[model samples]
Target: MIEAVKIKTERLILRQWQDADRDPWRAMNADPEVMRYFPAPLTADESDALMTRCRDGIAQHGAGFWALERMQDGQFLGFVGLNCIGHDIAVKGQWEIGWRLARHAWGQGYATEAATASMAHGFGPMALPRIIAYTASTNLASMAVMQRIGMTHAAAEDFDHPLLPEGHPLRRHVVWEKIA
Candidate 1:
């Protein structure tokens, strides 16, 4: 069994994935607005596979995208945590922090709250020297979160996403980095 680790913030709890997360996660992945920065909403199988990857990462590394839960009501908000950038992008092989919240959870500063805790864990317990984040150039919301977490845009490090086709609208991505 995978041992679960939990990180608590004033308003949120970054904890391990549970079977209850499946339906909400799939719904979040299916929301067009939620997946707007990406190419398209994920299929159910794709979402399930992604969750599998998250579980595997936590099992191996003791940390990954911890399931974001609200402290007040124990509601599953989505996920926020540190992940290794496995893709062959500008930030490849580096630890990156990310978040995705359900539509109901937006506009409440939850992303910033959870991300702050994640960064603390990464830079503190993990002893990571630096953390990086990247998103589609047009994703202003995520960019704002990166800034709130003290990540600065590395303009020179921006690159077209290697996984996207040359002409895709989301191909151009901007990178942000924070050094400990």
Candidate 2:
């Protein structure tokens, strides 16, 4: 098995998911604002299952979406890490960097900070040639974060998300990439 991975930033710790994270994770998944870019808010069971999946992914690969914790108070802010693009999107099977922070954590630069560190981990230790990020075209916040972390828009690679039905408002996703 691969060794577990943990990344630390000045103000955040990107580490493996824990049982204590389940409740906050569920609340964040259920928050309308937090889930606004997705199809819908997840149910408690769905939230738990997702957390379990993240935990298992880390165990299997030594690196995956990790629970973001505040270094000062050790609060469960959300998650930020690297994931293999599972969908048959334009960059299928490529490594991707992603983050989802609780409402309170927004506008605090945490996402950018954590994402920068995650990207370094991917390029440095993981030796990935490049990493990609994608979000609904309307998700300006996430798009901005991607740009702030030095990813450039790969406009020609944009595609309608296969999982969403035709004409769905959030189906057309923008792609971005940063080469190592």
Q: Which candidate wins on TM-score?
A: 2
Worst window of 10 by summed lDDT in candidate 2: 83-92
For candidate 1, the TM-score is 0.96
C-alpha RMSD (angstroms) for model 1: 1.3
* Model 1 misplacement above 4 A: 1-3
Q: What TM-score fits each model? A: 0.96, 0.97
Q: Per-residue lDDT tens digits of candidate 2, residues 123-143? A: 998899999998999999999
Q: Which residue ranges in model 2 land beyond 4 Å of their true spot?
A: none
Clashing pairs in 1: none
Error of 2 at 20 (Å): 0.5
